[model samples]
Target chain A: MTNIIWGPMIVLYSFITGLVLGSYIISIAPTLFKMRNLEGISTFSMVTAWGFLLASPIPLVLELGSPLRAPNIYLYPTPSSVMALFGYIWIIFVLLLTTQIIIHSRYRDAAWFQRASTGISAIGLVISLIFGGYFGFIIGSMKAREVWSSTITPITTILSGITAGAALVALLAIITLRKDGLRKDALNSLGKLTLYFLAIYLVFTLIELSTTAYAETLTWTRLSILLIGYLALSFIGVQYILGGLIPIFMLATEKVRTSTIGSIVAFILILAGVYSYKWNLIIGGQQIVEVSPQLYSLLNFMPTQTEILATVGILSLSLFLYVLGLTIFPIPEFKSKR
Target chain B: MSKYLKLQEELPHIVGRYIDKKSAKPKWVMVVDLNRCVGCYACQVSCKMENGTPYEFFRTWVEVIERGKYPYLRRVFLPRLCNHCETPSCVPVCPVGATYKRDDGIVVIDYDRCIGCGYCIQACPYDARFRNPYTGTADKCDYCLHKIEEGEVPSCVINCMGGARIFGDINHPESIVSKMLAEKSVSVIKPETGNSPSVYYIGYEEAVKAGAPVTVINPKIGVVKEI
Candidate 1:
């Protein structure tokens, strides 16, 4: 194993793959909701699945493991294997979702399209929830890292995904809602949805910490590391207090809800909160050692510059891909028409 | 002349009875004599060089810890490796079944099959498994199987300045390890884990500290406690 080569490439691939998949969890809900108000939901689903298809699969091909002896996640998939389940879900759903969306969009006024869109969107939501929950459990299965071993991880990840998806949808709404001259009811309803997801985020965070206390699993050093070093506070700060609470508080009164710039600010803060929440979870969980006397570093564990650069590149690609999707997809046109 | 010839014929058969049973549940074991070990790190260097492990990934390494502060102090050199237990926790949880115990009681890792997901590294209670940053798969001491194939002791055992680590099959009564276990009171690390580890240490209490409490009261955290 010390052997021939295939170290740096694998590490980079793991990092890039993680970034893309982690971000996809956030994109699931909004794409589903874009059915009637924008394109049919199936249209969005096809594009979303295709977007992941474009983004997530490239890294897998670059993996260092022997091509001959490679795991049959794709070809001869084990039914119980999580990765295989996701792969199958993506292929089948994306195809069905895409076909239905295109068909429905062509007949936007038809009764069948409307009902089918709703049904497909609901199915997509379930799939996304599974995707979200599995992402966290993947890390939690690493029993060596006590930080990542918590049962609360799966819930937290799903909560984060839904809330972040809402934020993205809300951002798009700001651009679209303006042209539509959307009244208080639509804004209020959407704002309420965002606030509810934010509340879920808070509950998930609390549950994670509370479980740690009950188990006495987290070391004092690790607890302090999570609190002081990173944006553990910011996850709650921007996502809940400023992004969710303050926006809801202001919108409840009436006049502040009308301020376009204030809504934009809320969008920005929510975006920041969601991104940093994921960043903290990934980076902070890794900072602590899993075993006694440590494994990554007998001396000191630090990420190399190459690893950091590769992470930035993958992140940039994810954002770039999202923008690419928004630019090409017809949903933005619906916003313009509105 | 007839009696002598008969005895010679039976001697090979008697010895062959245990040795030929290589498939018959080989109970791999090691006995460490702390009374003989000085604080020298010869075993650590030899194991590292033999394994070609990257700096931190020690298949077998020695730790010299000082106890009883003051004018009177004692330092003990304890060499550690994968204990190769019968019920290793690291085995079952591996998603790929890359790390597993062979029929011969060896905890072997098939690097070819390892996905380098590092699940096994985290599950090991003894902190024995190391994920080679270079290879991405879990790397560990294999009890120097290559040396055993060559009919020689493991590098650490062969290079031991003090004859501390005695490696052999414990099932055979005539083996050095089996005889040592019979003669000396040997103990495995954290026996309560139910791993039934092969590695045994004599005079462990005298050489090592009365290890971090048995009951795990309050389950103290961040104190650099041994697992």
Candidate 2:
């Protein structure tokens, strides 16, 4: 219940979200472009990919009591600790293997490069599903937190990540389009994906809220806030209505099709909507009070200034790596760049 | 080289050794007689002083629970501590091997290696474990192993003015725990969990049979409900 821990929690969330974003991009990258695309695609893919590799390990390491002691998790595992098990294999299979894909891609169409990216992408998808589900499992397993204790939490969290990844790629597509040349049809494709992900996110959010509203407990004030308080307004109102609907409506408009201020506004909304959704889930989940008298006191606790500064420090690290990743391996645009 | 000659030589040493060492020591276990417990929580206080635990942080805890309806209310006090189970759940779940079950069946934590992840705290079904907020690692009762090593009783048992607690090893044939084990029927907490706890309670089955303080049905359902 120490407020200072929230700083690490933020680091934990942003890293996992970044990892989810990277995994999803790799999964759909092939279909994203038609003609041997190599420009902006490679840039963000490499950036987010390497970002994910670095990001996912940070929380697991920091969460450990003794960093050296962590080796025992893989050595003599309890088997009940599935997260520790999956995390060990995940760090090996997803990040390390994916790096090989980047290495061989430099040869461009060399048999190894194509085979590695395709194979690693497949492995990344599977590992991401397990590792991503684990993030939700940890929250849900807390019997003390009834709102988070539901089995569906893992599913909802997984869905949110995919939705964020798809929306992000769509936004990136819009940004890259503005800088260089563009096909009106490519924008339409991004517009289509943006709409698809929005629908999925909305459905899942509704199902979770509707079910929770019935069997809710007083201990679950955090969930109540996410559903009824100011944050809930953003989650359902901006995220579901304005954030999601506005993008779909703009995509349908003739002005958006022709590329105007309408397109820029829609892209910005998607970005805001996604980031806000992430913030609400991470911060909102922690605000709940456990019913124990011991923990009740912790519920009224406030964050000290040091905690805020630590959070800023963690965010700075993520940002710096992301920028470095962009510089080294820019996403691909068209055929000739490779 | 004759078998009868060698047997004769060994017999004197064996009998002499038995005569010298017999009843020379006592093995100790903590036995709580709950029927005599008044829920004063003096034991909880003594446990704190012995362990020097942080304020509101505990190695041993007690709960006073309500049962039945308002007018028919029955309040019962149950003092809870680490079972120090023969087969401990906390021992294996420690990713760093920080928790270990000793040969004598006491479960102990290696604070130096425990990284404060609180994983073991979550795994304990009896809520026997607590995360030491300052250290961020799991903490729990060790059956007062340090005191036992020093030939002293656990502070809680010594402080129990009602003499509700008895401490001795159940292993020695003539020890008080072994005598009680033979002559009386008693129970270990959550026997169904297969933890094979070292702490024994007299008159528990009677309390349970009367449906007193806590009714842990089928006490063996030690499935992954908590951890």
Candidate 3:
């Protein structure tokens, strides 16, 4: 009998890492690009990235059969595996984000600190881009799983991160800082940006599906399981229709883009869509059951009680840390700046 | 007897004189004669008893493929296990180097070192590896290494009802595996994967072609029998 090796925890890890990367990319807007309208949410998004980054590896550790032995990946790393690079990459990210957050909070008024923060942000920008896309590269490198083994996978992951990141920042701005003069114009601009990234993600997904349809041998069977088999409802309904198309339509119209409830609905849909994509890609790829040369079956995998509880616990911890960061740090007051 | 048979009998005697010295390492290989396999599943049962592998998880298993229509129906038994490849895909992907190949070409896992990340399980194209729920490490066929170390044949080889499985050192010219390699044409599964599998098959063309996507053959289309 065939059993699934990777579970929903892997999907959660990938999704959370993408959010950290995407949020960091959004944070770069005001610091590097000098987008004044984005300046209010810039520091807030950086804190979001930090909160999510701290929570990111928790899922990976929980998923391991032996959590203590995880450090062995660093101690006896094999160069051929991309997973081996994770230890070093994660440490570097922690150092850089810590320095960036310290500089922004302590010395925003000092010229030297401003210059130093800019330099650090530039480096942070480069690291975020690589780490964000590398999440996709991790799966894309697995040549055995045809649905995940695509050049488009990494690019799609990075784009989806940006879409999710923008939605998150918009959601936070509306919810927490709405009375602080976080304006409709700023949220509208962010909405427009989210719409564009969401559109590109949809296009990349289409291209991925089209090319996958022609894959030979075992890959063809995998794709068949995805498109026509058990995953059909989530793949078609939740991902394409509710997540992609509806959000795009809502964000396309100016009235809905500017309206508070409309923008919230669109961002929420984008988040759901991206999360669904991660689930379908990582978990769906492992669900293809090949018993022998001629025999193939599909195994059903849903998050168990332990898995769901662990995921929810990690995310709730991240949200708690984010709120703590907001209170302790000097996040720019939207109304004071206005 | 053939010249090779004479050599097979005499070589052990010649080698006995050098008992003080370390003997040559065996480069193990197995040959599965598809023509002789009778779908008895004795190998499957013997392997499980030998390994004590958990229920529903097998170190080796039997797969039966039914082909063609009612009057022309054919049932083929394909015994499946790890290829123990020369370049096993599962080896490099192991983050902790827990899985490695031996000097004699047997792929093994260091149970103590495996972190049970399950990467190797997915890397294998043959569907040969599995996550052992008990140990939480990757597990697969090792060609009955423990039994071989005791100078005994693999359980499946000895227990095979059809006498289909042949095991020996392929590097020795007089060995049964080597002789069969010279005398009979053989094929390996998924040759395009470039794994250079050691297990060779005879009359596996139909079995190889059966990899095309499975379809629902109508119940009335194939040969039917009442229980």
Candidate 4:
């Protein structure tokens, strides 16, 4: 068996990609779904999504041994490689997002712009969804990694993205706007939506675990590592308890769902939980001992200090971009009628 | 002509080997005789020396599986390396086309072209590939390409104490490997993966079917350690 190759940066990249997709999904509620309550944070979510989308590839590039040769993905793309599609997908997403944001911010009054923005927003939404699924496909296509080789992986990942994305919108709505922010009804609605996604995410997580339990092949070794081995703490504690149950209870209760502090706490847990899920999936899948005669032992694969710092640095830069975006873009007033 | 030293004038007849170009290119194959293996890992050591692989990594490794309890106990030495598969799973998964099959059927990675994304490493069912920490590229056993070019055996083949490692071109009708394949039963590892590995094992059915759990025996203390 080989030592662990992928580090924390890869995990961070997947989490950040989900955020990009999730934020875009939240932005869709107002523009495409035409939910009036969601209108308050539609522009905010779009800008945030763009910030995350732009930052998504930075971690990937940083993780590469030869970052300069990354363009080879486009230069000599193998048709069968799912990772090769990353270049084209990122470009398409950026272009559609740029057009959609411009139409919404600059020409909100023009009927033609509204129609165009709606169409463009729909396209952006589809791209974001596929972008979310693309992260899943990247790992799921690796048939050798038994823990990740399943069709349900894509579905579970998309659901997890939705949960995190909706929670981000709700958290931002509460924190930025405060008392004079979005209506009580809108906040509560967001709370309920986040809860539903979290529930479904939990179900998919169970299904993933259960399927692994029944496998008769060497894949069962991976399942044992996840459940009873070193990874059990992260899977059961951080993901299920801190991320899942606690947040579900918080959002399910009407009093907490309606309260700003309570909802923020819940959203924070949701984000932690979802990120932990990704951490477990990416890192855990790779940590399994390859079939070796010396009795393959799992490595204590932790990211280096440099890798940790780089991850934090990229996230900080992404946040900085989001803050800069909020300043430059004149996002419509929260819940204000046009 | 200008009183220059001519080294050619000093040396006598040292006839070089003549390889026929008219014959078809030889398709290389390795046959591991499981019955002869002693699980000493001499080949593993020689391979690392030949390749200069990192400390934590291996170009070829030995798996010594211990099966059953006390009275019925048995051990199997399973030396593993890159299958050099015909339909290698790692080939297409490489985003930059760094990994490809040669005309002679060896699966090789071009270090110059590999971006070190480690995709092919994960795609391999045998866990034969690795991201070399020093080079930052995907690496695996290429059946000792340098030695093959020199018309010599692989380092592992030369080092095997039990004479379990056999390397030859299976395409040649007169080759020992071709004779063994025709006369004896052999099997490849993880054939269900559909990788069609070129490496075959003689008398491997029992060990392969056992799927026994193994433990590491600390070389110094000779203590069996559980992981």
Best by TM-score: 4
TM-scores, chain B, all models:
0.80, 0.76, 0.82, 0.84
DockQ of model 3 vs. true complex: 0.33
DockQ values, each candidate: 0.18, 0.15, 0.33, 0.42
Model 4 regions more than 4 Å off: A217-224, A290-296, A334-338, B1-23, B211-227
- lDDT tens digits, residue span A36-121, model 2: 33333544544554555565555555555455656656665555554456557566655554564466445555767666666665
CAPRI-style docking class of model 2 based on DockQ: incorrect
Q: Candidate 1 lDDT, tens digit per residue, A1-338?
A: 11212233333333333323333333333444452233222233234433443454444434423334345345444444444465565566456545544554456667686577666656755665565566566556555456677888877776766665555545555664466554445454445555666677767876887787578777665666555544446545654566556655654544544466766666566656655555556555655553232212111234568655755665466556655654565542345453
Native-referenced Cα lDDT, model 4: 0.80
User: lDDT tens string, model 4, A1-338?
Assistant: 35666778888888888888888888878778877777777788888888888898999988887778888888897888878878888999988887777777778889697778778877887888889888798776667776678777888889999898888778877876674457788888888889999999999989877775666433455566767889888988889999999999888998999997899999999999998999999988777655533244465777789988998899888878877776777777543532
Best by lDDT: 4
lDDT of candidate 1 at residue B107, scale 0 to 100: 91
Model 1 residue B36 CA deviation (Å) reads 4.3
- Worst lDDT run of 10 residues, candidate 4 chain B, spans B13-22
lDDT per residue as tens, model 3, A113-138: 76787888899987887777886886
Interface CA RMSD, all predictions: 8.4, 9.7, 6.8, 4.2
Docking class of 1: incorrect
> In candidate 2, what are the lDDT values of residues B1-227, reduced to their tens digit?
79999988776444321112123443346678877788777888899888877666777765554445567665545566888877776666566677887766678888877766665665564557776766666778886878767655677877776767767666677665677778877788767667777788886654434333232211111111100
- Candidates 1 and 3: which is better by TM-score? 3
Ranking by lDDT: 4, 3, 2, 1
lDDT of 4 by residue, B1-227 (tens): 43334544432211212111212788888899999999889998999999999876888888765666677767778788899998999988888999999998899988898999988888898888888878878889998898778776778887888989877878888877888899989999878788899999997777745444445442211324344
Could you give me the TM-score of model 4 versus the true structure?
0.90
Clashing pairs in 3: none
TM-score of each: 0.72, 0.70, 0.89, 0.90
Residue pairs that clash (backbone atoms under 3 angstroms), model 4: A293-B63
